[model samples]
Target: MKDVYLFSGFLGSGKTSMLTDVIRQLKEKNLKPAVIMNELGKLPFDSQAVEKDIPLKEMLEGCICCSGAEKTEAQIQSLLLDSDFDVLIIETTGAAHPVEALDAVYSPLFADKLNVKGIVTVADSKLWLHRETLTPQVRSLFMEQIRHAHLLLANKTDLLTEVEQGQVVYELQGLNPHAFILQTTNGRVPLHLLEGLKATTQADKADIVKAPIASLQLGSRLVEFTDVEFSQEQFEDWVRTLPETIYRMKGYVPIEGIKNPMLFQYAYGMVQWLPEYIKMPAKLVIIGENVGSLPVIGMN
Candidate 1:
């Protein structure tokens, strides 16, 4: 049976960094491994940064737990048919719910061939301590990811003192007594901890208390503009002024003067922009709650 692993965590929880480590170590042991990186935005950074030698399948434009489910299943099936890897690692979008992600993986087509060896979740220590400060929907998303984890890595422990790390572990244990929790720095977990994970099945899962995912008002909007450039600083200022309800936003836009289309992302109150080569329509997918109207730099 082929082993399948799911790595889940919230945004900026270090899932990609950990996955990169696992892939490198697995290759050193002469094990063939493949990866699936799922993203909510069209522009993908994690997949592009991973070691190019390993086979990678990028699942983009939507969450694998929802709209991207069908595409995810098809891609995995395609991977299994083409090559027999020692393990298949699935890195879910930070916003995804673990149960839904597993449902996608356990689809009937590959049910007999693939065994879910484990579900590894990485938790941001600082975020966990201050979860109440987050919006209800964001907090729920973070907690739900921990609910069904077989292994929970309380990552970023270095940011806290020893006493604080212990408290975080204890609190998380209260939330999920079944999961084995380990603390790490920069997601530097030992490979042995990932081995021999008890294979889990649908029968093992408890009836999940459904979160108000629909009521959370999660949505996406596509905004388009005629090719034109605006002052980079002005564009960034507009991004910073977005309402707190806006959780994530990304797009490629043509700047008034810059030659290359600019790729930008706003998440966790942080905004970033970079030069991108993919020449698509100058459009942005704004994802948030009640994201009614946004500032446009150069529009027709």
Candidate 2:
């Protein structure tokens, strides 16, 4: 039977980074891994992180647990029939509920063919510290994700002070006494910690009630910048002017005087720019609450 692992986390919690690391480790061990990525936006930005050689299925424009559940089952069925992979990794949207995601994956048709591992959740330490600032619904969803995690990663610890880090660890431990919590930077975790794991048993799962789908309706907008090169300084200024409702933004941006587009990522008021050697499409996906009302570019 193939091993199946599910990744659960909020927006900009570094799920893709952790997924990439997991894929690399599995490949090094001579294991073939297939990926199923769900995105809230129309564009499949995160899917690009998976290599072409790896079998991949993408469910776009909805949460895998809700509207995409049927599509997800179909995709999984297709991958199982056509792919030669030994392990399956499913990464759900940031707004997805852990219980619902698991429900979609536990299809009776293929459940016996897989050995279900567990949910690996990445929690941003800084976000945990300021979670109260978020709307009650979003905060509840975030906590639910952490509460259901079998292995929780306190990610982005590098941005937290020692006291804050300790507080995050304490809070997470209190919320999930059964989980193995690890403090990490950039979602880095040793692969050995993830192996031979089992999902929450039937009795343990009985305790988790499904979250209200109505409360988790985060929005996303895909902005394409074709043949347009932005001034780096101007872009950063524009990002600063964005409202706090915008939680995560990521994609490639073409900068003036740069030969290739730079990978841009913004999360929780922090922006990171990494030089990309390859010429990726110049598009950005902004995810947040009512993000469609936000301007694609703040500067004229």
Candidate 3:
């Protein structure tokens, strides 16, 4: 059976970064894993930043709830039938509903073969209080994400002080008392967070999980590291010539003597690049505002 790790979070809450870290750790331990990612538009960004050893299936053109349900199911089911991997990590769209994504995973023909070890909800601790009224659509989406989470990760803890972070966790815990509250800065977290958890599908209404309407956010600090080889000359040149609104940039670079390319990521001002110890070289993903270039990979 495949142990599935379902990841959900609001925009910029660091779900993508967290997923990449988790995969990196798995690869470091020599474990095989599969990944499925969803995005609202036609492109997939997170799917590109990760190491290439993992098989990635992208469900695009819709959020997980409506537009891409059946296709998502088919892709996951096929991954199960074909791959003998250690785990399945799924990153849902920033605007997605985690329960809906979980529902799709547990749909009729697939549940017996899969086990849901954990539900991770990454939230921006700083934004949860001040930006409570951001948007109705986003508000609803995040509510669903937090409500279904078994591990409420209050991400971006560095944005707040030690006490403020605790307060935030307290508030969130009150909302989802059953969930284990974990405070984080950028999504760097312990691997045990995903181990040995039990989940009953929504179809099993009596065992369903839901948090209160109250607000809270928590998560781990983001860790960026890489050993990918490349010319600092070209990378710096690319940055110097980059557009103004390039929010995040991550991909691979072919090293001078290495057979496999290196993995790299850039967010805000920080950049990270790592060598693929277990995976291969694949597509490059860059996300930005008014950032108009398409990723090299056409998977989405």
Among all candidates shown, the one with the greatest lDDT = 2
Candidate with the larger lDDT of 1 and 3: 1
Higher-TM-score candidate of 1 and 3: 1
- At residue 129, what lDDT does model 1 achieve? 92
Residue 153 deviation, candidate 1, in Å? 0.3
True-structure lDDT of candidate 2: 0.79
lDDT of 2 by residue, 1-300 (tens): 878888999999999999999999999999999999999999999999999999999998999978887798799899999999999999999999886786667543455466667788999899999999999999999999998787899999999889999999999999888688999998988888889454321111112222221212243445656657888898999999888867666677889999987888776788999998877767665655445345566212
Candidate 2 clashing pairs, residues 3+ apart or interchain? none
- The deviation in Å at residue 161 for candidate 1 is 1.5
Candidate 3 lDDT (Cα, 0 to 1): 0.65
Once model 3 is optimally superposed onto the true structure by TM-score, how far is the C-alpha of residue 269 displaced, in angstroms?
Answer: 48
What are the Cα lDDT values of the candidates? 0.74, 0.79, 0.65
Listed in order, each prediction's TM-score against the native is: 0.67, 0.67, 0.65
The positional error of residue 158 in candidate 1, measured at the CA in angstroms, is 0.7
Write one digit per residue (lDDT tens) for candidate 3, span 84-180.
7888988888877765565555443455456666578898888776657778777767766776677878998888988888888887776677677
RMSD to truth, every model: 14.8, 17.3, 19.1
Instruction: Indicate whether candidate 1 or candidate 2 has the larger lDDT.
Output: 2
Q: List candidate 2 stretches off by more than 4 Å.
A: 199-300
